[model samples]
Structure formats: structure tokens, C-alpha cells
Target: MALEWLVINAGLSLPEGFLAYLPSLDYLHDVQASASSLSAYISPAVKASLFILGVVASLINASVIPSSLGGPGNAVLEVQAHRGGLGHRTENSLWAFAHAMEMGVSILEMDTVFTKDGVPVVWHDHDISPEKCRGDFVGAYIANLTLAEVKSLSCDGQLAEHPQAKIYQDARIPTLEEVLDLIECYDNKMVTINLETKLDPLAPNETLPVEKYIDDIVPLLERRGFASRTTIQSFDWRTLIGIKKKFPKTVIVALVELETLMSINGEYPWLGGLNLADFNDNWIAAAASIGAEIVSPGHGFPWTDTIHTPGYEPFVNEDMVKRAHEYNMRIIPWTADDEATIAKLIDDGVDGIMSNYPQRVMWVGREKNRYVPRVGTKHRPHCLVNA
Candidate 1:
């Protein structure tokens, strides 16, 4: 009934840079859902005028201005590069994070699992994947390898099955501090790290115990001065609970997927003794109970994505979005790459998109009038990535 102005602004630090007062939910949804409506309905002259208006607006706003775009109240859409743009380069390598930072990803989404000596290193699988890495160190569990042994391997850059992936044949598994130090050098305060604990609840022996993360991981982040800029996420809620009880101020993200939820087994201790059944099976409330500010569900979780298999329904639809906000929690689903799926997530009003290809998501956000984190030119160290 009323027009609302969503002033999507960035003051250079907080990820919450974009802000817009939407007129109505229905209106925003209508606009987000209509990706091609402008080309279909608007005249060429008007489109050109809108393009020019957008250029001028971008000077005033970080994202392309909404005045010429589909709808009003286009707030910030946080774009996270899964495994720090895994689709672009090697997954979780210093090379990957640096490339993603250059590409303007709001969050460098990487997995962190403990090494044999209790040092936290950035790696996705507890057991190293043969497809992604190669060396004498291949086929060994990351937990069995000391930090030095893990670092000796070179990345093959074959992750996520992206065929055209730019391979950095010499890339190595970066320690958690090395990854953060790379970001520290880039000096982009707007960017953040979504560091996942990468622990599997069902297989506890493969990864280190939760206390290592609480004792070592938290302090590392704190010392780097990135404590305020980083988010600690995990599928196993055990570590999340530990961090909350000890630190009490860390930004905790409770991750949910079919496996972690124990979809077949009912209540299991995946959620740090807080069962989903106890919260009426509402994962949002379960996450909120632990002082989690964000609840990240697997994309199209509990079901599956139609992108891979058609006719499958997504779990993060409109109603779920409302339910998440009701608990004062944000829903940032994971690692989707397809354009149609990405647009649908944006339409669903998810706070962010964790994608292997963040540039594609940013393009969609621009088309849909959401905050696309400004891409920065590289001033990073030359010896690091050898561009």
C-alpha cells in the first residue's frame, strides 16, 4: 500500500551494509521473482534511461541502484564463495581465498578441521579427497597428518567437478592463520570469513574433539583481530555450544543438513544434546536456543535440489524464511551454483548465498537489486598466488 525506500548502504566494515525499507512483502517477492519482466515490458528508450540511471545511482550506492531495477527495498544479499570460490580455483587454498577476495565475495566460506597435532588447518574433508589433491601425502586422513605433512601436498584444483577450473598446480593447503593472514594483507574490512568446523557428528573419531576448536580456534581468531569479522559455523553443534558457553560472544552459525539432522534416526546428539524433536522439529528455534545469530541449512535440504534432479522441491521456501526471521535468526543456505536456483533463493529472501560461483550470484543480485559486495582491485602480495 505504501512505497518504502531501501537505502542499501555500506560504511566499509560491517557485512550489514545494505539497508532498505520495503513497502510490502508481496511487492518485494513480486519484484525478486520477476527477473526478465523488465525486458519484456519496458521500452528500449526506458531501459536505456534506466541503465543510465543505474550508473549514476551506483556512484551513490555500492550496488546498482534499485530505481532502475525490478523492485523497491532491495536489501543487501551477502555473497559467500563456497570454499572461497572453489569453482574458480583450488578449494580452501590461499590461492582460492585470494581469488575470491579479488572477485568481491562477502564471505570466504572455507572448512577448518584439526590436524594431528591439534592445530586448525583449512581443509574440507577429514580424509583428503584424491580428486582434489596429489602428493605422497594423498589418501591419508587430515587428522592423522601434522601441519607440516598436510602442507607438503599440492592442490590439483579439480574440486566440485568444475571442468574449466583455473588450476594452480602448486597451491598447497593453507593453515587457518595463513588464510586469515592473506585476508589481513588484502585489507578489505568489508569481507568476512565463514569458517566451518567441518566435523561429522556420526563419525567423531575422524576429526578432533570439540574442545580443540574452543581452545585453539577461538583464540586464533581473537589474536588476528578478525574475531569481529569472522563467523564460526559447523554441522556438528557440539563445538558451537562449547564456543558459546566459553566465549559467550562469538558469532555462532548452526549448520543443518539431512545427515546432521539425523533425518532417518530421529533424535541423535548431532545438535549438542539439543534435539530438533525437543524444539518441535523446528531447526530455527533449535539454533536460536544456543544463541546462534544465523541458521544455515543445506540448499533444498530435507528434500533435494531440482537442479540436479528435476521436480524436487526446496525446503528454504517462503514460509521457512518467515519462520527463521521469527526466531531473530538469519537463513544463509549453502553452496548452490545454478542460476535458476540462485535466483529462487534470492526471491525467498535468504540473507546470503553461499555459492561456488559467487560472481554469478552477484550478477543476479545486481539484476534483482540486491547489495552486491563491491569487487576490489588486487593489491595483495605477489609471491602468494603468482598471478
Candidate 2:
């Protein structure tokens, strides 16, 4: 009977040496099966071996299997709501930014273009586009328009086409001060504010006096007690340098847009004739020389080889990231909302990502166990999402 039990336990086969132990295991089972048949031949050593095997199996099942099922721990990914969560509402409107706060991203990224009245308003493009602004205001220029006039134009043009943004229709173009109010009202410090300086790129005459504009905006942020949490960024190195010199303690980031630079009146031939290749060596160096700590370029510059130039390979590469890091500057890529593209950027070790959909980036960070959650979402004014 002991031999039979051992053979069954061993799946009817055993090594030659283990075959000798089979008789012993079978005897122990037989003795245990019936108290009346218990025998002194059953050794405590065999009982201990069986107990140890059970313990080992339990440990393996708990540690190995659960770990395999759970996969990797959560990773932290810097999630900057591009134009304040373009996913939920119209991009850059006060309502949209408020919505982003509700989504609980690590950063609130918004563009600042001076109104004709010299007011620095939060907006992305230098001029309003047909895609975002519908009706008579579709192609109107932003720089030439006053804050009141710009406010009158609705950015929720896509609302009819995309119902998710229905609440965005009445959204107004919020002033820099208004954004600060939202931040302060929530008492949210985990969230950082990234303000993009959208200066005149096409209409050279529309440019604002650099120092004066900087003074106006910086003071407002300081007055609101956001100087420490606020980060000023611009594609124009001069603006960044000016802002840095005036507010030396404030965090400053340099923004780079590849397509805009390549455009006729954009940053490249229009602003400085420098492309992605010359950015790190020349453009980025200039900002770094002025003590700029963060550099945000288009994500395509670091990952893709497909140049917008037909039949031409992309000039941007991983070398750009290495060079930026060596300078002790953080690299935060811009405007990538797709999960796959964002994952690639995070994997490439970017300091942060500027995405329209901050939620996706936030989840990516939470999944990787490395995220720092920001302030209240536009959905909930009092809660924060932490990773």
C-alpha cells in the first residue's frame, strides 16, 4: 500500500534512487489513512519533507504567480495638461483649464499671447485658427485683437462636432490672472503652472516690449503667490532670457516647436534660421546660457525619423536628449496625447510630457509607480489625484 501511494504521488514514475523512497511514502499514507493501521515504521523525517514541500509550493504560488499576474508597479510620469486638457473641453479656455484641474494632472500648461491692449491672456496660437474658432471669428488674428474682442470669439467651435466639449461653448478666453484665481481657490500646490509666451511670429510690428510684458506678467504671478510654483516658457529665447534675468528665482522653460520653426514666418527661417539640429547647439545653448533649466521641444524631435519634409529623414534624435541632460537641463516634450507615443517618451526618460490628454499620461504614470498627482480636476474642485 505504501509503494502504491508513492507511485501515485510520483505520477507512476520515479528516478531509480527515488523508487526506493516510494515504498516509504506509501507506508506513511497507509498508516495515516487509518488510525487502526498506524505503524511505527512511518518516520517523522518523511512527514517533515512533505510539510516542507507544501510550504514551498504555497510560497511559489503566492510570490511567483501573483507577481506574474500583477506585472510591474506604478511608474510616475510628469503629466502637463496641454492647453489644459484638450481632451475634455476646448483647448486653453478658462473652462478647459478648470476642467484640467478637475482631471488632476501634475501640471497645467497654457499659452500666453498678449492682447492688443497689452494684456497677457492665456491662449495657444499667435492668431486664432478656423479649426478652433468658428463663424466670423474663425480666421481673426489674436495679437491684433483686444482681450475683450478675443474673449468675444468662442473657442468652443468644435463643440457641435464633438459633444464631449459641450460645456466649452460658453468658455471665455481667461486672463492670466483668472488662471491664477482658479489655482489659488483650490489651494493646490502639487500642480505646477507652465505658461507659454506666444509672441508675434508673423506680424513683427505686433511684438510687445519684452521687458514691459515680462514685468506685467511676472508681477501678477508673484502677487498671486505663484512665482514659486509657476514656470515661464517661450519659443523666443529672448523672452525667456528677459524673464529669467528679471525673476532669477523663478523656474523658466524653453519651448521648441518644429513645425512652427519650419514654417515660413515661424521660428526657423523667420525667427533664427535654426532647425532641430541647431536647437541644442545654438537655440537651446542660448537659453541654457541664460540659466534656463527646462527645455521643451516637439516629441517628434526625440523619437521619430519621419521628417515633415517629404522624402527626407528626421534630423532630431536621442542624441538631443543626451545633450540636454548633460547640460543639467530637463527635457519635456510637447503636445503628444496618444498613449503609445507618450509611453515611448516616458520610456526615453523625458523629465515630463506636455500632452492634450493629461488623464492618459496620469494613468501611465500611475501604472509605472512614478507619478506626482497635481491639483483638483475641473470635474472636482476639491480633490487631487495622486500616484
Candidate 3:
């Protein structure tokens, strides 16, 4: 009966006596037979081997097969450009965003802060630092300056720590509207945006009120028709919950640091007054309760060094990935730049990775046969308009 089913559905016939050596499928009728129905009968180890072989074959032939058939493997892990490829360009600059798009990033990760006049702008830091920018008004707080005032600062200088790095000139702070316009005009229309709302718990007045922030940004996203293509992320869970209540369909990413989990004193402000201990440090469950479909945890880099205690463990591990997957959540770690670490994360089964150098991540993805091609445009120059 199994052989007959295979011949009818898959167009393949086994030897006449194959069924004699095969295990009986008393429950076969309960299963839906498909092209890859044989996978159910195979051992898990053999299934995995077949999947790897299929991926290699597809890569060699330049064709993709449905993952259900064990063909091109699982869904492609998303490669997000952190602050628009900050490793190679000034963080959050338009040029950096364009460069990342040219490199074929799956998603552009950035931060949003409100200008003094209540304009949403693309910037990472709450307070301007002279290390990344140079202007007449250095060390100014972003909330205190108008959009025009913010634009006067040039983020073209190389970081003093990395003096040998390339420097770009005339790159000024950009409004959220400007960035959305650029993404729309970009030839590759499939690239998504992961915009983080920069809110300070210690200094709430320095940023827009939670209600005001939602009111200001959601409309902009809807007007730009990016409500579907953007994921609103934040360390502050309150804002995310607020956004979820308002825009139910819009995706939200819960960003976490080691402090969020390891706060023995329960003093972490990013949790929005929720105690990690209450959830037994299961941040994934905590995020899901608030309607987050994705969780972006900090990569356990030694330099960050937040989780080095005797019992402390990296937040994004194999168990976390498995648990997240069980709940239909994605685990995409942040700012992984080193090739070795990126390779390890891919091995650990992350849904995606946010990196400062997207090119490096792309290379690793290709090596692992996990590279997801861009949705539009095959070839382009480094700049958007020229491309």
C-alpha cells in the first residue's frame, strides 16, 4: 500500500518486496501523503542528512525547492543591517541605509527619536556625541533641537577609537519621513524596516511621551504605506504593548539586554516595571504575552560582558530558540560582527541576525545555504539613485 501510494503521489516506485522490509504504517491513513511523505518513515538522523544534501543540490543547480519536500532547507534566516551597516558607514545616515540596501540586506534596523519640535528623526543616541558627529552644537540633546537644528550636525567623522576607518562628509541627521521616502524610492522595494523607538526611562522628558510617540509615528507609517513593512521595536515593553493595542496587525519586536534578564534586584527599567523573576527569566514568554512576534536579544559578546557570572548564560541559546519557535516567535540576535560568532549563531538556529556589517552576514548565510535573496532588483550600484 505504501509503495502504491508513493507511485501514485510521488511518481516513484520502490522494489516489489520493499514493503516486506519496511515498518508497517497502521496509522498511514491518518497522515497526508505528499512529495516528501517518505520523510515521516525515515529516521530523524537520516532526514537531516537528506535535508542537507537537498540544500547542497539546490545551491549547485541554482534552484529552490519547497522546504516541505526537504529541498532547499528551512526558511531563510533574515539578515538585518544594524543601523544601516554601521561598521562600514556612519550609523543611521542615509548613505549608510543606501549602502546596506545595495548590499542586499533583508531588513534595515534603525532608531527613532523626536526632535524638539516633535518631528521623528532617525538617530540612535538620545544625546549627541562628538565622537560620531561634528558641528557647532556638539553634545546637544536631540529632544532639545528642532529638525533644522539637528540637520546642521554632520555625522561624517570617523570614530576616534577606529581612526583608520573611512569617513563620509555632509551626512546629516535625517527625519523618519525622509528615510521612509528613501526606502520607497529605493529600487529594492522588498526590504523591510525595523525601527526602534528610543525612550529613556530615567529621563522621560527627553523623548516623546508614550502616547505622543505612538500617535506621531503610527500615522507617519500609515501615510507612507509602511505600516505593513515596518516592525516597531523597543526596549520599553509598555510602548510595544501600546502599539500592539492600537495597531494589532503591525509587527512588534521586543528588544532585550542582559540586564533585562539578570536583574536580581528587579530594577531593570526596560521591563516596564515587570520583574523577570516573576516569569522565571523566560523573556520569550514575557515578550509573547505582550504580543511580540519577535525578540531581539543582545548577542553575548565578551566586550558587552554583562553575563559573565558563574550561573549566568547567554540569553539567546539553543533552548531559547527552540522555545521561541514552539510559540511561533523569532529569535534574531543583535550587533554580531565577528565571523566566528555569526557562524555560531547560525548553528544555534536563530531566525535572523542584526549586524553592523551585513556583507559579512550575507557571506555566512551563503556558506550555510541559508541566504535569502532580495525580493527585487538583482544588481545595483552602492548608491540608490545610481542603482
Candidate 4:
């Protein structure tokens, strides 16, 4: 009887009524026959029908099966080298960018701070942290400090303890121009760049005006033909908006966090900012409202309160990725370093990720058959030998 059902579904050569009494059938041996006998019994029309059915089913499976359903190979994890492959070399150095290229990352992520002379330099923080730099205050802003004065301070800091800290030896700060040049040298491979504009409009004594900074960077990108390869990102929504207004062709990514937005209603109006909720409960909507092409949120946002906080549910969930996709936005979470967490993000359907160690992203890519972009091509101080 079971054989009858198989024959029906398999479109095999059999009596049309053979499956009608399948529920009551007892002995399976009744249908058993030699292969030659069965082949002789199959009519040419039935054989053709069965073959056609198999082909139709195959096409249906191929068309209906989600491209992402077939194991990890279908997943595309775009690797953005945060701080220019910080795991390989010093953060934001030319060496780091070059190394990222060699590793074949999807994007090169770096921070930018303007010099006093309105020159955009590739450095991570406005005020160097005690962790990355062991030094006195260089001044309030990068725009206030000359490139020479900025270079005098040690860019390397205690990334690890003692012997493990050998990576922090001779890493020097790199200018934004130098970083852009390095990226161009790679012939603009698989890598796109996410340039964070660290300029705070609320801060006092702005060294580089918004318009001036735009003027300085846009032409350089146009000349290098990297205007399309570049993405302007900023926590400051206004800056992103400005970039959009100025360069409609270039991609602009709006960066948001739960912290600063919550503080916007505070005593100092300047410190207060736009909350994510204000944009219709969707960060993508907010970005789109300002003509942004991409939406870049931190890892575990609105899910994990602290960076180390465990039990991230929605932040790394499929639902979040689906929602972002529904909005026609790509989910590229920032600075997620853990390998397991990164894999989870890929499985959750994120479009890409920003990682300090692009190598880990590349390893996952190789295992999953995803392509990682290559970067890092410039001279750097001794500490960046690995970079």
C-alpha cells in the first residue's frame, strides 16, 4: 500500500486505481516485481509524463527555495575593517588600511577628525583615549592641533598587557588623504569605505566648519573616482544630511545610538539629539527621511544596553534584519568582534558587519564562501609592521 502512494507521487507506471485502496492494503510483496518486468509495463506516455513531472518539480524547488536557505554559502558578510584592521595593526594607520586590503575586506571603516588648518586626518577619536594614547591633552579638537603637533604625541596605546602589547610600538597617526591614497592603490577592489565624520557641531570652537570640510573631501573623492566607493557616516545626523545635500551621488550612512538621543531632552539643548523612536520606530526610516542611502547601527542596539551585556535577543535576530530589509535598508552593525556573535549576525540575515579584526570576518567568509575585500597599502611606523 505504501508502495502505491510512492508510485503515485513518484509518477511511476502503475494502475490509476492502485492508490485508492492504499489504506486497506496489507502485503507489500503483491507489488514487488523484477526491474525488467516493471520497465516493460511502463507505457511511453506514462514515462514521458513522469519525466516531465520530475523536471517541473526540480524547477519549482530551484525557484521557490530562498537563495539564503542553502547553507552558509549563500550568506554575504561584508567585512568593514574598523579603525583599518585594528586587530592586525594600529587603528587608523595607513599600515592598517593596507593590511585590510591584503586580507580582502568588503569595506574599510575609519574615523576622521579635521585639523586646525581644515585638513581631514584619519584618526579614531577627537580626544585620544588613555587606552589608545598615553599623553596629555593635545587640545580640545583635532582642528585646533596642527598635523605636526598631532604627530608628536604617541598614537599607540596599551591594547594588551606587556609582552602581548608589542603591537603598540611605533604606530603613528595618518592623514585622511594618505588613507584615501592607499585605498585607491588597491584599484578599488571589493572594499568600500565608511568614513565617520567625528565633527561635533554642538562642541565649542569648531575648527573646521561643516561646509569647509565638505569642500575639502568631496573634490578629492571625485578626482580619485572614489565618490561612489565612499560612504559618509556620522553620529551627527546633520552632518550626514549636509553630505547628502552637497554630494547627492555619494552614499551617506546615518549613525545612531540610544544614548545621545535619550539625552536630547536634557538641560543643555545642544547636547540633546534626535531619538530613534522619533523616526516612526524604525531607524531606517530616519535615515531615509534625510536621504541617506544606508543605515548603520551599533551591534546589539536597543537590545544590549552595554557592549559586554549578554543575552542579546532582538539585536542579533532575524526579525531585526527582516524589518530593516522591509524598509529597503541594509543592516551593517558596527564593531562586532566575537566570532560566534559575527556568525550569529550572518545567520540572522544582516547585510554586513564592521569588525576590528577583519581577518575573523574573512575566515568566516572563506568557510561560508563569501568574498572579503582587501585593503592596507601604505608606509607606516614600526609598530605597524604586521599591518
Candidate 5:
């Protein structure tokens, strides 16, 4: 029966009468003398060989079978390298992105702020911090500097205090165009770019106007053929709304910091003037209403006290995950680096994880047998050399 099942389901043909040498069932007996006679008909060596073959066949079948055939419930969770593995390399630098691609992360997560001349550049903060960059314009905002001026700053000194700071050498800030060009030219494997549009509401006038910001980026994405491969993420739902209206084919991710949702006055700047109370404080539904394909909430630890309200404890619980999945929306918690917290989030049934150390997420996924390899790349173990 096992051989027949394999032939039918596994598309393998077997020799006719392969079991013809075996004794008929009617002649079989449980008695020791009958058993001894049975061994004579089928030699011990042949019996052992058949057993090994059956094991091999079963393994092959398991690999090819679909999830419906008693396989895992969900596909492998996506591993997004936040700011191109900021834990290991200088954040948002081309060098960091290259190392992340080499490690075969499913997504290269980055943030973008426009330069003074309206050119989109890959940078995390609106203002250049002395901690991350060194130049005459160390404390100046990217919006006030041209792309050339921004590129002159060195990112290598940003990680001077890091244990692996020596690895950071001569790295400069890269423009969004340059990053896309590198991905197109060098990376052979499939990877998603989760690019966040950085907008500051507190000082809105200092950043690019919303209309111009979208205008500048959409064309670049279309020209580079990245609209399909990239997901535009933002804390500001207005930007997500704009993208949905203009580039309907592009994917959007709604980033939510739970503390930002604790507003009782309905004035959460991050929500783009949309009140959480209007959505019953359900961020998942709110994100879905704006055509967001994914909802990314921060991991509720370390920053919880800083972001969370005194009494509110909004979190990415199992119920929230179920709600998002029901809407065909994916839930990916952002910026989790520790194993224990990551394990908890996985237990809550997140669809993916965004982390500064994506290799850690990949490792946890492998431990659970849920790690999915990149489409065009062979399975490579998580890069742990730096860790």
C-alpha cells in the first residue's frame, strides 16, 4: 500500500511484482516458527533495504507536499532587516544594505528623507545627528542640504562606540536612487524593499511638502520598476492614503506605535489627523481602511514606558493578529532584536518580523521550521560571523 501511494502521489514508478517474493497473507502466522519461515522467504538484508527505501520515499513526499496535506499552517515568516541590519552596520548606508542582501534577508527595511533639492535619499532621521554622521553639517537637517552636501558626510564614525565599530569604515550615506541601482545591478536573489517615508508633524514646514514628497518618490519607483517590489511604510497615514490613490499597485504598510494610539483627543499626529477613537481604537481596521497591505506595530518593550500612556496597554496580541488576518492583512512587528520578545511575538502569530538583527529572527524562524528562503537563492544559513 505504501509503495502504491508513493507511485500515485509522488509520480514514481515501481517495478511490477516487486513484492511477489513475499508470502501470501493467508500463510502468515504470529507463531515464532512461522515468523522464522517468513524470514527465510524474505532475507534480513532485503528487509532492511526495503525499510530504508520506504523512509527515503516518505521524506521526499513530505518535502513536495502542500500545506493542506498536514503541513504547517502558515508560510515562512518574512525576515526584514531594519535599516539594513543596523545592529551590525551603520544604518542606511550602502555597505549595510549590501551585507543584508548577501545574508539573503527577505526585505531590506530603510527610511527616506528628501534632500534640499527634492532628491530622495535613504536616511533614517530628518536631522543629521552627530552620533551617526560627521561633517561640517553634522547637526543640520537633510531637507536643508542638497544630495551632494548630504553625501559628503561619513557614516563610518556613527558606530564608533559599537563593539564591532572597526567594521564601519568609509561608509557614506546613499541616495534612494543609488540603493535601487545597487539592488538592480548586484542582487541576484529576490528581495523586498520596505521603504518608510520620514515626515515630521511637529515641524511639518521643515520637511518636504506632502504632495511634493509623494511626487518625487513615485516617479523614481516607477522608473526603477520598484513599485511592485517595494512597500511604502509610514507612521503618517496621509502618505499611505496618497500612495493608494496615486499608485494603486504599490504596496503600503501602516506603521503604528501603540503609544501614538492612546490619544483621547483624537489628535494623534501620526494617524494623519484621523482619530483612533473613530476606529474604536482598533489600529488593524484603521490601517485596512486606508488600503494598507501590512500593519507594523512596535514591539512593546523598552520603549513601552516612553510611548505607552499611563493606563493604556495597547499591544499586538493574538486577537489583533487574528483580526488583521481576517482582513487578508499581514502583521509584522517592528524593531525587535531580542530573542525572548521575538519568540513571544511569533507566539502571537505575527506574519513577519522587522528587526535590526534580522539573522536572529531568521534563526528563530528556522528553529520553528518556518524559515522561508528567498525565491531565487539557495538556502543559506543565517550570517552569524558578526554576531
Candidate 6:
């Protein structure tokens, strides 16, 4: 009753299935006693919250969180370093990942594309753009080059656009294996790796098959013993659906953009063949259909980058978060770097955020008294140096 009443107090709607998991009386009593602090934030529910993401992902299925764990005031948003904190270093480079980890980001979010020899390389664009890379490898598709050839390219060159981005002195695009090895080098067991598959359903030929992603990544994560802390996210929902059924240990995230969520190729293959209208046009519902533990939507109108135009309307709001919570799914919106946007997201009750700057999130998290991950000591890990 107290849990039910408290949900009402928070002005959060109860889904039809909300009754399936009610808090025990002991937890209810704690909530009653801490009514003062309960008003501060949903203290007791933090047990089953997205704080639940890191700890409970292995214990539960993708769709439902059957119970709560502890008293409230414990919900902490995971600060995900988008493209390995690209605002600070070259996006998805070892320098960026290490720096972001050093700053105590809970998650290092990076993108991955396959090489010609079927090796998975950490990169965003399928075709290496001259904008981020230099040397002979420029303008070549990542899939067409071997891992050795891909390594010869330099991604540390700063462009006029990323004026504030710090150069890492000839940083190379590290492989997925190298990234996992670096995490081991840091010795930070609590940190999670949110890796995205750079597979474009619109242009499938540009990248390897979805099976290769599943085959390559799952085994590699298992082999590295990082399976428990790894989150595999993709705009293509096919991987999410497959990963859940095959590699149940890995946390699957449904990454939605304004474009992916909209119909494409006269159908919705991007969404694992499900249309928006299938679930009353709900992104969270559509995500849940494919067994996603977290539903990550784009920040606003454009839904691609963090930059907002004049009078930009947001795709994420309180209602979106509430609906996600009702379905027992976590909401961690992508690419919100500004202090105001981060604060508003926290206020809206998002589970976490993806950002290009870790310091900004850390400052806001501290100011708001939200739990940020433990700070990592700086290190030039063996993986980055040898590579």
C-alpha cells in the first residue's frame, strides 16, 4: 500500500502490470519513517531502479523487474561517456576511454565496426573519414581493411570542429579486445562497457552481418570475463532480440532515434521488424518486445547529436521516463552534454545519460547528490601503450 501510495505521490502512473511486484511491509515501514527524505527522491524504489541495471542484470529477465531490493535515496544515474568521452579526446580511442574511466564514468560507451578479416574494430563510421583520421587509410571503408591496416591509421588528429578536443599523440583505433583488456588493466571491476554495433539496416552491405556481431562480441566478452558488465546497444533491434535469447548474460539496450523509430524501406526492419504502431506507437513497448533491459532514445527533435537548434522540442520527457519505469525498463537517453540538459534529465528521472563530457555530468551529479561511479586513478594502461 505504501509503495502504491508513494508512486501516486510522485505523480507517476502505475502500469497494468505494476501490481505484480509490491514492496514488503518492512520496506514500506522504512519509506514511512523516511517520509521526509522520501520527498527528496524515490528512495526505497532505488533497489529495483536502474541502479538495478549494474547489479541485477544477470538475475532477472529483460522485460520485468519482479521486486525491489532496498530503501530509497539510492538511485544513481550511470554517467556513460559517449564515444569514450569524445569531447575530451578522439572519439572511441584508447585515450578517450582511459580518460573517461579516469574521471569515474560508470560506463564507457563506444561504437564498433568490423574489419575485412572479420576482426571487430572500435570506430563509428564504416568509411574512415578524412575529418577524424590521417595517413593512407583515409576514405577506405572499415570493412574493406584488415585489422593491421586499420591500426596503421591515426585518429588523434584534431579538426577545426573539435577545437576543444585534446589530442592523444598518434592514438590508433583500438580493437574491441584491446578495449576489454584496458578495462582489466584499470582494475575497475564496477565499470560497464556499453558497446554499440555500427550496423546500418538501411545499408546492410556496408557492415558485417548481425550474426557476426553476436558471434564475435559475445564470445569475446565471455572469454574476457567482461560479460556481466557489458551492455550491447544498437540502433538495429535485430541484435537486441538475438543477444537476449542467445547471450542472456549481456544487457541489451534498444537505441532509438527519430529516424530509426520512423518507418524505413517501406517497413520497420531497423526495429527487428516491429513497427511503432505495433505497441500503440510506444518506443519503450517496442523495445520491450525485443527483450531490452534499457530503452535509449535520442535527446530531442533531431535525435542524432546533442546540439539543439532554436526552440528544440525534446523526445525525452517525464512521461517517457515514467512509462519506461512502469514497464520495468530503464531509460538512459543518448548524448546530452550540457549542464542544463543533464540537470533536466535528472529531474525527469532518467536512469542514466550518455554524454561527450564526463566532468560536466560528475559536477551535476555531485551537486544533485546523485551517486556517480568511483573515480579511476590515471594510468597509461599497457594495452594503449603497446598498441
lDDT of 6: 0.73
Best by lDDT: 6
Note each model's CA RMSD in angstroms: 9.3, 17.8, 12.2, 16.0, 12.6, 10.6
Q: Identify the superior model by lDDT, candidate 1 or candidate 4.
A: 1
* Clashes per candidate (backbone, < 3 Å): 2, 18, 0, 20, 0, 4
For candidate 4, what is the total of clashing residue pairs? 20
* Candidate 2, residue 156: lDDT: 61
lDDT of 6 by residue, 35-130 (tens): 222244655565345333422342242212211121111276678899988888888987888888677677899999999999988898999888
Per-candidate TM-scores read 0.79, 0.67, 0.75, 0.69, 0.74, 0.79
Candidate 6, residue 212: the lDDT equals: 88
Relative to the true structure, candidate 4 reaches a TM of 0.69
Q: For residues 1-387, could you state the per-residue lDDT of candidate 3 as single tens digits?
A: 222223323323233353343232211222223223433556656555554553345335311222112211145778888888888777888777877766657788999999889999999998888888888778888888988888888888786543543556867888888788777555434567899999966678777687767777887899888777788999887788888888788788999876555564546677766776777777888888888988888877442333433543465678778888877888888878778777877888887899887888888986896664332222223333411
CA deviation > 4 Å runs, candidate 6: 1-74, 303-309, 381-383
Task: Residues 87-164, candidate 1: write the lDDT tens digits.
Answer: 888778787888887775767898999999888888888887778777887888888899889878877746556876
- What is model 2's C-alpha RMSD? 17.8
- Could you give the candidate ranking by lDDT, starting with the highest? 6, 1, 3, 5, 2, 4
C-alpha displacement of 220 in model 6, angstroms? 0.8
Q: Which residue pairs show backbone clashes in model 1?
A: 6-20, 6-21
Q: What's the C-alpha lDDT at position 167 in model 3?
A: 56
Task: Encode model 2's per-residue lDDT on 1-387: one tens digit a residue.
Answer: 122223233223234554354331222222222222223354667644644564354334321221111111113456788888776777777666667756656678888878778888887777777767754555666667877787777666673433565354545677888777776555444457888877654555555655655788788888877776778887766676677778788778877766545545334532333444555536557556668788788776543332342554323246776667777787788766667666666666677778867787877765564453332422434321210
Local distance difference test, per candidate? Answer: 0.71, 0.61, 0.70, 0.60, 0.69, 0.73
Where model 2 places Cα greater than 4 Å from the true spot, the runs are 1-76, 134-138, 159-167, 259-284, 301-318, 372-387
Residue pairs that clash (backbone atoms under 3 angstroms), model 6 = 43-72, 43-73, 44-71, 44-72
